[model samples]
Target chain A: MPLGDETIVLSRRQAEIGFAILAGLAGFVILFGAMEHDTGWSRSGPEAGYFPFRLGMLLMAASGVILLRVLLQRGPSEPFLSWGAAKKLLAFLLPLIGFVLLIGPVGLYLAGAAYLFVAIGLIGRVPWLKSGLIAVLVPVFLFIAFEYAFKAPLPKGPLGPLFGLI
Target chain B: MVENFTQLMQGFAVSLSAYHIALMMAGVMFGLVVGVMPGLGAPNGVSLLLPLTFTMEPVSAVILLTSMYWGALIGGSTTSILFNIPGEPSSIATTFDGYPMAKRGEATKALTFAFLSSGFGALFGVVVVTLLASSITKFALLFSPVEYFLVFVLAFASFIAFGAGSPLKTIVSILIGLALASVGMDTISGSMRLTYDIPELIRGISFLVVVIGLFGLGELLETMQNPYAAKAVTTRLDWAEVFRSAMIWPRHYASLLRSAIIGCWMGIAPGGPTAASFMSYGIGKRMSRNGANFGKGEPDGLVSAETADQAAGSAAMLPMLALGLPSSATAAVLLGGLLIWGITPGPTLFREKPEFVWGLISSMYLANVVAVIMALATVPLFARMMQVPFSITGPIIAMICVIGAWTVAGAPFDLWLLMVFGVVGFVMKALDYPLAPLVLGMVLGDRMEDAFRQSMLLSGGKFSAFLGSPLAVVISSLIALCILVAVMGAVRRRA
Candidate 1:
């Protein structure tokens, strides 16, 4: 994961502009949502949306300024993400997404083990034996720590009843 | 003051138990591990451990967390001196002189100076907190909703003025946080504000979940993009040399005092430890007699930075306790923890939970000593721990983040929120948007809104309600001044 010379994937200028636009759009959505309820003062006090409505307006204003500044900027923009960096980030992130999604169906322990096995063995290129050991040991440790020691339950999913841990 | 002292003594009685002492030691050790790790910081470490504290008493929980904070601060400097990698952000300045000194075969001297000075700084900070705690709380007790709202304004305004980064970006970051906080239910009106009719949004967004995502997974992703090898400088600590280095503490008294004052001021003012350390380092370089030797390897440079960093880290706790305003991200998380534990921070907390307050304050005194000793004793152990490949630690950390998120409210939705915020955190970091303001915003959003709405109701929706009282007038003026200074500074920079 050490940085090396690589071609640009996203330029800083583009990122700035894109994110600002997205934020501005988010601001509009928030403002529109605020309008669903009264955004002004009522007989009791300020309405639920009063503070958020102002926040939404401020967000749009701030983001609009950012967008304008980036759009008008001159000279070279640095690379926001190089190709190699993006690839590396995705390699880690995609699996993380998979792990989170898997948690719903398989529970935390199994999902965690599966994620670690793939992450350490396949992506990290560690030897299978060590990766498998960590993959198994970590979830077991977490199960004990969370369940028995802390008395807090994690999502144990379908196999929970078999282990009687849920 | 006498009453405070009496309460403090009673607090000592509560915290001196074998069980509490053991928790302090365990916390420091765990914090050291977190601090010595690059991607895992004090805030993230504390939040990750928060779920476990649910079953513990508030006093015991606080002792553990605060001790961990002390350990992490000390642990961060270890990697700075040993590996030229700051385990925590605040220790970045330590590397300026700490690494160079270590490279010159004075590893023992550097570590000793860092540990001793940091210990002194933390002690000084805790003492300040102890002395000022009563007065500040008493003053805070007089605050009306107008003043409280102004306090929140002042906090954000100070960030724009004193914080490093674009003020607009800071504002945007804060707005995003406030918006996120407003999601789910409006506590005041009992209406849904920003949930977009989603069932998950009804519970409101938990700041803890966001914190885990931003600092935990976001930092991990950032590290993946630009990884560095951790090659530690191997050095055995000699007790005689350490004793000899400790002998020269008096020579740098001026630097220590100056840095400690700067650190305390920054901590209280919301500049935070990272900024305080950097500022102290810059000022030390200019003021010290050995100024030219700063980067190459100056003991004073390392001392000043480490002292200020730790001093600020401890002093930031004062405002969180007294004013219910968190000056740093870690403090904000601790404040959240306090909230979850059913202890509301403020002047009322002091009046209501004297045992909890004093116990925590007393623990600070004990914890720093324990942190310094533990840090010195376990350097080799942590140094070995650092060698564990990131490939293994990375996935383990991600798993911790997932587990942390799931446990916060046990909602599957929070896991997804964690992922979303993780990406947002990464982008915010890359874009140079200060994340502290956002965290602070999330922590204080509801409170600030409550204050504002209450004030409005008090004044029948009149805007002048904010300026009604003299105290409010003064705080409002300060907030205005802060924004003005920021705007002027921005204009001058552009010019």
Candidate 2:
């Protein structure tokens, strides 16, 4: 039941307030964008902005209510995320972010392999040999399955030209 | 009725090919894996497989998808019984009694009962769909733009009335979904609405990418906060125990029937399988003769929950097909798939594509049978797979999600979008905001807008256009009633 090492990084109340404010900002942006066009009922019918304009208002109103309720209510401030949990999340997420960044330059196959190797070996603390095996095998399997069987081409980056996969 | 039967016979001809049967088996197998894993689910599983079905015939594609759904429903119960972990949200109720039964060395019996009752409930649900398909389609054909818009309102209202969340938060979630859906080109006025001058925004945010980020990567991130160390109870399948469990089915016939009916009603009303299973379990505890021993490894409790879960899962298809209203997130994803295939879901679908409609229905019958057999045969395999550490499985799943998002439109921008939605999904779950309404809104937003505009055009731009017909009046009143009930309930709880 212990989710983390028990040092609270953010409280539930703070997170709620922050999110509500962000939503309000998003609502304002939507409204601002919506007003670029005619937000009215023309002779033809309701204009395009008419629907989105009302939607923006409704979003702002809903978030405002949420913000007000959270502010007015008095309660215990539970931990939203602990330091340990945050560290764990970052460990998983950072590599994923790297994988996404790597996808554009190295293609899906190589980036995927590199991601699997690091994630499994370093973060997961698995044995290097097994991690290397999985890193190599999975992408190969995906390559054959996607390229040959399904014929849905995935991004291969430099590897595509080198292997004549493109 | 005779005509319906004849069409169904023709549907059998379309779906009964050897190739289609193989697809069912493969889909079910994949579904079981997805269902057994705690993070992966039917919605994620279906979305991941959606791109693969792009080349397939609609009937074959749907059969594959529906078959995977049946397999996931059945697979979800396996983890609940063996590991006391519900793989799918709908199967959470099964753990109340299923885990206890497994602990008492009746794992085989518990699993058999769960699978058999699931099959029974699914069969019951399909029978209901078969009988009511024509009538529902007929009723839907009478709808005008007013009625269609009202139906959308009714769907949202029912979510608020029945949702186990704060109404304000649910509204915010729904509004966000609608706002996101309106981002691309405006179909009605032939102008851009909310693109914000971004090139990627012109195509709009793909719901498939949203789904991949939200349910797929979002679940992985959440699961990482507290990883599951699965301690599975080892049990080999015994034929004698299975036969014994099958023989006792008649004793719990009333519970099974009652739960199936509850499930069907909930499915059609948009309460969905998670709610249906819990409702059936609670009601079964009150009504059963074994009520005294309800939660302590009671067979009737397991039966009630599993039956209702599968029943609702199958029965939810009716609304999605007949009215273009998906009652669950997975069904919403399927609705998205239908649109991708250029087949508009509604009453006209029945008239124009009898083979497609009937083929899907008939395949349900075949898929559930295949699901039961496959679920039983592969229990040990999945149970072993569950023993793999989350660290390894987690990365693999994340990789799969990345690939899935990329495949949607092969846009790198979607990968970024996927990341943003993942964060949103995790935060929303932590805050107890319902995700299903958001998904429902995203799927139906454009259509709802069109219905509203068309209604305005029809009624000469009057706000009173919604109540122009008696059917519209009834729907509007129902929406009002749902909101009233929710308000009164909230007030009473506060007081």
Candidate 3:
């Protein structure tokens, strides 16, 4: 399981704590919303928040139990993954996230092309000739498939108009 | 029963049209591609195509989606055999014998046998669906609102008890799903509860975000970390050998039937294909003379896994068609597709839109045959696809994931939700929590809410009235029994 890199072990406790915190936060939001909206029964029937209010309480209780169990349990801590593996995952994830974020301003086609080029050329270390060809072709292929066949609209930057050989 | 048969035959006529047939092929092809590739799965793949189907006929659309479903199930076995990687969760058991067979240069034999068994299992499940459709509809009609509510409870309880591991974790995942389902404006009183005045939250979390993020992005992240070994596979397919393999498959006829039976029952009962495949494989191993060879390339092992996997896959659609209840993640997505098509799937659906229901069933039959043939013929094609570097595939998959999320609402905010849910999906996977229940919960949450609310109104808001009907009593008792067992298990563990 070693990936030939420095690694830090992530215990079950740390993961459980994070999950419990998430549950607690969700519980608080739901509880507050239920209270604000009123979970009481009206003349017709139950209020909108009635069932969710109870559900929120159950969620909070479950989180409490999880927190308590993690605190009490002495579980074995195993190596989660190597730093290299983690970096590999984050490498793709962060770039993809960035790609999505960039799509808003740079447009889908341009953003997509840039993401592919960089991920393949820089991150993957693939040859420029191969990566460059795929980068150019993919967005073009998508443009035809979605825009022409499906008649779907994609986000566009100023350069998007140039592809209007359509 | 005779009338149902006649209608199904008529449905064949409707679905056999050149246009619908083409759509079926397209659907199956799309399903196969995604099912073979890592990261993208049947549910997300179907969801990606769902928005495009708005202009198509409901019958054509449903046929296409269901065809994709069948193809995905068929496609998963191919990946399992050739690459030792299960493209779908249900195919995990196949890897034990399938990969071993491939390693021993029996890849063609194993693939042929698995495909044949899968086809046989699917056909058997479809026959069961066809014969039992009317009767099942009758049974479902007995359900009142209270009974409907209790049925959902029984489903959730069944998953929590029988899912992969840790009932408590399953419960937590289901609760997380239910909680997320409550984020949008409450439909009952027109009050936004969990939105916290955020306009984006008003529509609530889209299940598409959760599904694509979990199965698509999360799986991609997983693959990047724990990459599968790229093993060499023999792509030689000999007709004589394939025929010999098929001929000898009858030796496990009993196992095949038993697996199909197990698969169909589990599929209908909500255990789903993964559980059904494992159960069938386990039983086959116990019964076989070469039980010791189960994991080392036994043909019976391959047959048992494939048969049950395909059978359970096809049968999982039964509840969705009959009671509007989805038994699997892909089925849930199909359910969402149905809702979008403005078709309320219940007992009345068959009575109202007989053509659509029967056509879909008939298309299932055709799609099963088509998918098996296509899979067998294209094994080499998929084998090559297996060798394509994930570096190239990964970015393409990411792009598609982006398009899927963006197309859902045509908003940047939805992409952010997709990313958020992607991280949540990754964490959940690491935590060993069963995710199927979460997706199912979100899909059924709205329907369950309506049933619970209406039942309260009908009973004058009295909780005791839930036990009035015999059907309701039965379902409630079932739920109570499950909870009791869970509690007893907990108490025993504490001691």
Candidate 4:
């Protein structure tokens, strides 16, 4: 997408537009869905849909006010997302994607260690040995602390029982 | 009250255990480290450790978490004073003057004052927790679901007033957060809202994941964007320079006492550290002719702001522990931890588990002393941590975020949800929405629904029951007033 103007600091109108659409969608979804489920203030004391229906009304009301505010606003233009900023954001985000993809295939400890090492090295650029040591040690410690010591069951992958080796 | 004292003495006996004292010390140390690290606030630290609390007895868990909170609050001030970086939202105001003072070659003095003040402030909060816990819980427990929801709504409305320039965007960001909160299973019915055929969304989103993304990952991204920002370098670290003995007792008596009172008041009111610190600092500044030198390495200014923040941070626990009312986001997360531990907060806790309550309170005394010593002793080390390039911490925080998200549900789908929330958080940040309220709303949303249902059911579905109780009426009115202020601010802006 081509970049918008960069000089503006606040973009109220754009925000309102986005919120309005979201609110309308949320309202419609809840209203129709709840009505279908027979949401009413009848015998079962305010039916299943009663609270949700009210919530939908709130969503619509808040969004409507937001939409009106945005439409009325006028000021310096804003670049919603700049390429430089996006790239910087992506630097952190892409690794996040990798970490997520790695989570299930590898258990939390191993995956967490890998994620930690890669992230630390990527940001700090410490000596490889130091970074590696930290990465391996942190997750191991956490696993021992939470999983073993605290008895909180963290995810264990195919190497599940093998994790006991650590 | 006398009985409360006897119970407190009993609590001291339980807290005096070497193992429990050691845990408090460890919690303080860990909390300080987490707080010193940019982007990981008290709430994130407490929530991340929530799983660990499972193995602990309730008293130990509460001690660990509360002490950790104390540590984190104090820890945040270290970054603000040393590196011009506030570790959390509460510390933001601290940097306005704190950094300026550090640059003027009084880093040691500034740090010392902060440490002392924070300790004093926390002690103040503890006193309130001990004295007023029963009464406070009774008052807060009377609030109905409608009142509680409106409190969320009203607290959210304050953002519009505060974020006046982009009120529309702020409201939008809040709605986005609310909508995101709605994605998981419906609290009233077992039905899902926006799961969209994914089982991961069935559990909804983890508040920790979103916080990690916002504070840790978002900070990493932000730091990278401003990579060329001026670096902080300090050369001097003399023991005598850091601690002035002659002024110690006099400064201590005045600064500590004033900051503690300010912290307790601010903590009870839910104004948070930002307000508490600034208020204390302002009072300190006004009291002394140090006004001109306040931000320029004035030892007292640093002490007042830093101390008040810690005090308020500790005092904030009063509401959470006693009333089940969280005065800040960190307390809210602690609330989550309390719920997870199967311990219901509020007045019943005292009657049901006095030992647990007393032990936790006694642990506070140990944690505060330990935290002050550890924080001051490790000053140089933490300062060096600031030198760790953003490039490395950036990726590492990202990794932690993933682990944290996955840990929340052990599902791959949550990883995606984490990203979605991260984007939403970033957008919210850009649009000027306060993320805390969103987290609070989501955390409390399910409970609010239940409270509403229960209250109605009890009253035979009489709508007026929400306001029938005097306590409920008072709270509901306050909530209404807050919303009125927010709506009025929005309307005036439009006009």
Per-candidate Cα lDDT values, in order, are: 0.90, 0.91, 0.85, 0.69
Q: Candidate 2, residues A9-128: lDDT per residue as tens digits?
A: 889999999889888888988898899889989887889998889999999998999999899989798889888898999999999999999998999999999999999999999999
For each of the candidates, give the backbone clash count: 1, 0, 0, 12
First chain of candidate 4, TM-score: 0.79
Each candidate's DockQ score against the native complex?
0.82, 0.82, 0.70, 0.40
lDDT rank order = 2, 1, 3, 4
Per-residue lDDT tens digits for candidate 1, residues B393-413, read: 999989989998888888989
Can you list the residue pairs that collide in candidate 1? B184-B201
Error of 2 at B432 (Å): 0.2
Q: Per-residue lDDT tens digits of candidate 2, residues B1-495? A: 888888889989988999999999999999999899988888988999998898889889999999999999999999999999999999999999999999999999899999999999999999889889999999999899889999998999888888877888888888988888888899798888788898889999889888888898889999999899899987478878788978987689999999999999988888889989999999999999997788899999999999999999899999999999999889999999999887899999999999899999999999999999999999888888999899899999999999988888899999999999988999888998888898888999999999999899889999897887888999999999999988998898789
Best by TM-score: 2
Question: Best to worst by DockQ, what's the order?
Answer: 2, 1, 3, 4
* lDDT of candidate 4 over B130-161, digit per residue (tens): 78766766665655555554455445555454
Model 3 over residues B157-219: C-alpha lDDT tens digits? Answer: 988766775777787788878877878877777777688788998888888877888878888
Evaluating just chain A, the predictions reach TM-scores of: 0.93, 0.93, 0.88, 0.79
Give lDDT for model 3: 0.85
What does the lDDT read for residue B104 in candidate 1?
A: 91
User: lDDT winner among the candidates?
Assistant: 2
User: For chain B alone, what TM-score does every candidate structure achieve against the true structure?
Assistant: 0.98, 0.99, 0.97, 0.89
User: In candidate 1, what are the lDDT values of residues A82-153, reduced to their tens digit?
Assistant: 888888999999999999999989998999999999999999999999999999999999988888888898
